[model samples]
Target chain A: MLARTSLRELRHRPLRTALALTGVAVATAMLVDMLMLGGGIQRSFEELLRSRGYELRLSPRGTLPFDTEATISGYAELRDALASVPEVAGVAPVLAYSISVETTDSPDEPQTSLRALALGIDPREQGLLRLLEGELPGSGEVLLDRRTIEETPLSVGDTVDLRVAGGLDVAARSGRARVSGIAEFVFSAREDRPIALPLEDLQSFSEMGDVVSFAMVRLTDGSEPDRVRADITARIDRVEVTTLTGIVTEANERLSYFRQLALILGSVSLVVTALLVGTIMAVSISERLGTIAALRAIGIPRMRILRALTAESLALCALAGLAGLGLGVVVAGVLEDILSDFPGLPQAVDFFVMRPSTLLLAYLLLLLVGAGAGLVPAWRATGLEVASLLHAEEP
Target chain B: MSPAGPARDTRGVIVVATDVTRDYRMSGSIVRALRGVSLSIPEGDFLAITGPSGSGKSTLLHLLGGVDVPTAGNVRFLDRDLGSMSVEARASLRLREVGLVFQRFHLLPMLTALENVELPLAAVGLGPGERRARAEERLVRVDLGDRLDHRPGELSGGQRQRVAIARALANDPAIVLADEPTGELDRSTSRSVLDLFRRLNDDGTTIVVATHDLELAEGARRRLEVVDGRVEA
Candidate 1:
């Protein structure tokens, strides 16, 4: 009966109830958006790393994969030592550098220089790139990323002139290779398209003999990447060995700022929800003090009254939480669309992804906030002196 | 000093008050609402307490109904000391034994007349079906069976008072305490309420009314007039 009374009261005061629900829903939506952003980027990066068959990456110490001008000096010795391990299936050496590509077919037209990420790999290794047309690149051949083909006049069977960007203490190097195939590579940074060539030829043309940026380690079936990474780190010096999990952990650590900002904003939203709900409940309870006092005089227990009031708040919050979930999805979808066009983020990576567990936790948080917001008013209602309040005039 | 009253029946005494003095602190001044006043109400008695405004008639009724405790002295209902009981315990006692009707008809504005009557039954832990049946019977007795679904705002002043009276009797309480139950009704409506009370008293339910109306007071089997916080002959 108390619950029914409470529901009836809420139904009668539609404007106040709607205001409280809107506050709760807006706060819940903010929290849901934060949860989506926190997990989406990490999951997308992990998927990108796992797409290649490589289990471990070896890069120069203090350098990331494809870091500009970063090269390991003893690549041959490192490769031989890694291949000697029992669990090692194959090792693909890579030399990645930023270079300008110009079309030789249209030299008379003002030469257009487009910057591209050039990757040096072994043709026989069947490495990271997924070929869509023609064969893999040979000694004097190149494989252009599909994006590169679409962005520029470059295509399969075209010979392009490439010039390596000059760095400190190293002069600019130039070379030409036939575009033998068009393919897709997951690691292509959003700002630059990728083009692949033979590692030996790239080394000879760039005058960086026996120097490579990183090595991709393909493990045998049933081999654990952690154990292999640890062994390689023990065998090699001045080198860093990492698995996909390690890279993701590092990336998430760097992105902790986003999580912190979300926490602050989400906390503010919760406080706003609590204050809004609490104020409305306080006003409603004050208005009904006479009725509550009458109920008390007629022998209704304080706890039962409190339960009815809290149940009303919980009902409002539950409705708001469901609405917030839909609102959050729409907001996340907008964020995803906006971020997909952002530079340096791969097209395959999602900016906001909703996981079931994350959404469940968000709902639970809203429930707690709702109950907590109602507690102050419920306590006040219970503490009213039945005799005094009954005698007191209605407010 | 005790006021002269009709012959008392010792075996049927249901409420007793001894030297009750209720004081209030208002704006730094001491106001004694009930100063050394005492009374006894017997079972099945229709008693009227008549007084002008601020004569402490309502305060005495509150004390007798276990809604408030006196600042000094003791009040007992059915041989149980109300002053010695906790607030919750007094509430429980009221739920089981005492019914109250307020002057203002403090029915929940959102609930129907039937639901308002069922509220007290729910407090006593009755199941929904049983509460509904009992509430319907009480509303019928009050001639409000057809108006069971109407809210307090939709009912006339007299009808609202009848609903309040019906709600007071929902638990079959041992005693019903009404404070000016007909104060807001017209003459005909007030007479009807008085007739209903007389009929309930004849049916063996103890009824106490606090009012300033001479007609309502004259109908009681015993009457006490209060002035300046003291009862007079």
Candidate 2:
């Protein structure tokens, strides 16, 4: 009887049913994409941080504020002294610089700001280099950010002209370095891009000599990073020392606002979906008032009528949820390709990974929406006056 | 024709109505649809309630069928008071013991002829195969064996009404309460439906029909005409 009633209600007004389905699908798809985007960002951040083998990122006191810029220097004598700390495993001196490159595809494109950090270290730490191709660049070679590929036309074995910040003369360095690789860095609390190279070569070419911008440290096993950072900060008065935990915390604090905004938008979409479903179900119940009365008159119990209607609502929601899930995956995939051109986004993040727990939660929410929409109508149908409704006279 | 056994008189009265009255709450006023109607129907009896429009015959049928409760008096079916039963229990009883046919032949629109007959059985705890077989048998009995898969919208008025009858008889109930079963049919179709009711009565399936058509009412074994909610001599 429920199957019969549901089918009849759905068929009676095909257009309305289709509209309800589409509304639910749209809402569910949006919800899924929102959740996927959040998860992808978190994953990309975590993976990027873990790849560098730096358990903690320490920065100067009040030096790197959110949406602001700051830098610290590593005096050669201080670097040697930091390596003498008991928990210090190794200190890789880093020279950081910012520059912009104009791609052949769009020459007038605003010089997109990039964080080019030169690492003065042995070329043996392959774990530190998250490469998408060939190999890590030698001293003379430079590796671009992984996100730069989609935005620029520079390919393997191509010479890139780089214009340093505050330098009027564009450095047209002609050298064919193997595409060597592309890599990701920890997402910043502000707009920051990552580019890597052999540390000493960058200093000599850019005329910024002997000044190490920062030092990335790998701690020994079982060494508490905060204790190490505190010890280092107390001893070093000339430059600031920031821990990796501090860096991650600051980054998350900034991303949390965007995540909350996404959540609010997703919730609003779901509420609209609920209203649409409720309206459609109400009309369906009203239109089928006569049929409900007929069933009741035939000695069919009121509860069965309620069950039948509830089942119908659930089936509708399930069907729409499944369709929406599929659509959401496709939409996210397409968006991923489009977002590739924008380096501000986390690179190569798969935004359509549907987790079972997420799908389960979504299904439950949709079921609740379906049941809630059907409640009033089910109650009204059960309470109908059988004699009045079933009488032969058309009133 | 009685079954060849000692008439199971110990089963008690199958349906008993004592001073049952039904009233409608109209626009700011209560209109009495039935007034102090009392009747009892034993098993295997065929009774007809006849009245004009607004005469309350349908009200009486509803009370007797347990589709409704009287506003004043009580209706007891098989020794259980209809008014006392919980809503769920009443529905269970309807599924188990009572079959209803209406003037409009209220077949579920989406169901085929056979499936429409099978609908009432769905709420029962019967297996799917048994439900299907029973529905098929009932449809075949109603002379719709060939139209098993034809939906109600595809069937004629007579065919649709036959499907309703098949649905009513699907549960093999104790009583079949039909409210103007032929009210929407042509003269020939009405006679054919009345003939079907007569045959069902002959088989000792208790039948109570509410109607205004004289020809339909006159053919019943027992007749009670209702006027202003009271039985007329």
Candidate whose TM-score is highest: 1
Deviation in angstroms for A242 in model 1? 3.6
> Which ten residues in a row are the worst by lDDT in model 1 chain A?
A104-113
Poorly placed runs, candidate 1 (over 4 Å) = A39-55, A66-68, A102-113, A122-142, A149-184, A218-227, A243-246, A339-351, B1-11, B28-30
Per-candidate TM-scores read 0.89, 0.83
Taken over the whole model, the C-alpha lDDT of each candidate is: 0.84, 0.72
Instruction: Name the TM-score of candidate 2.
Output: 0.83
lDDT digits (tens) for residues A152-208 of candidate 2: 666666555555544357454422233456655443221344556676666666566
Per-model chain B TM-scores are 0.94, 0.94
Worst 10 residues of 2 chain A by lDDT: A64-73
Q: How many backbone clashes does candidate 1 have?
A: 0
- Tens digit of lDDT per residue, candidate 1, span A72-140? 987788878987899999988889867788888574556556888778898777466889998899988
